[model samples]
Target: MHLAHYLGLLHRSQANLASAFREVAAAHADEPDIEHLCLRQAAICDTHAERLHPFAERYAEEAPREPDRLHSTLFSGTRTGGIALLRDLQDLYLMASECDICWTVIGQAAYGARDRDLLATVRDGEGETAAQLTWLRSRMKQAAPQALVVAD
Candidate 1:
């Protein structure tokens, strides 16, 4: 019944995450790996949102008025420099973490509602979201030593 609210939340979150990823990718375009991977991940986020559309519409009638502050901005703009890249990745990790948890919560709801399609979508999205978090974490680790300990 209340699944629609979560579906909407997730849809918007995915869109936001995708946009942030693209922003970071463009800002850090000199980092080839980051640019390519961020763009790829953005596409994944878009796919996740696309998959959720039908479910959101199906449950729209049952959804109550969305509560205020259901959505919050995670990324403002990307920064420059090595340390900035690390910081930007940290921001991304946090955003991806939000998506990860939402996938989990929605997966549970899908099971309760016996929605196979939604569950499948959640499962796939969860894997991609986890990969995004892992990459962000690893990239941060790689950048930290150079950014923090080395003389600029």
Candidate 2:
């Protein structure tokens, strides 16, 4: 059914998030914590996508053609300086939030379909996604003071 469409959406979104993480990590390499955490989160996104692949393929046979414009770009690229770091983290927060919601929806679908494997994957991924959001939020809060208030 429409589950395939969402599976595809989540898959692509995970890939996009991973790439954006790597890009931001590299762009802000000066910030060691940001770089390390971004890299770790990128790996987590990759694992989530890998887990979803078999399910996406299995349901595709029953799924209608995917809808157009199902995907949106959240992070174009990273920018420079303190404020830019905050903005980039905000972009990541938005992207991770998308993945978080998708995981919830898909988890519900898995429960309906009686798919234990998918449910477990969703549960695990959702927790990690939540952690990513938390870290992003905290980092943004830390950056805001310097980015918005303190002089260069």
The residue-by-residue lDDT of candidate 2 on 80-142, one tens digit each, is: 765888888888888888888889999999999999988998999899999999999999999
Supply candidate 1's per-residue lDDT for 89: 85
Relative to the true structure, candidate 2 reaches a TM of 0.90
Q: lDDT for each of the candidates?
A: 0.81, 0.83
- In terms of lDDT, model 1 sits at 0.81
lDDT of 2 at 73: 51
The stretch of ten residues in a row with the least summed lDDT in candidate 1 is 63-72
> What's the residue-level lDDT of 36 in candidate 1?
95
lDDT of 1 at 150: 87
Model 1 lDDT tens row, 7-104: 87778778878988898899989986989999999999999989888888888823322211222343544576658888888878877887898799
Q: Residue 68 deviation, candidate 1, in Å?
A: 12
Cα RMSD, each candidate: 2.9, 2.9
Question: Which pairs of residues clash in candidate 2, taking residues 3 or more apart in a chain or in different chains?
Answer: none
Q: Report how far off residue 108 is in candidate 1 (Å).
A: 0.6
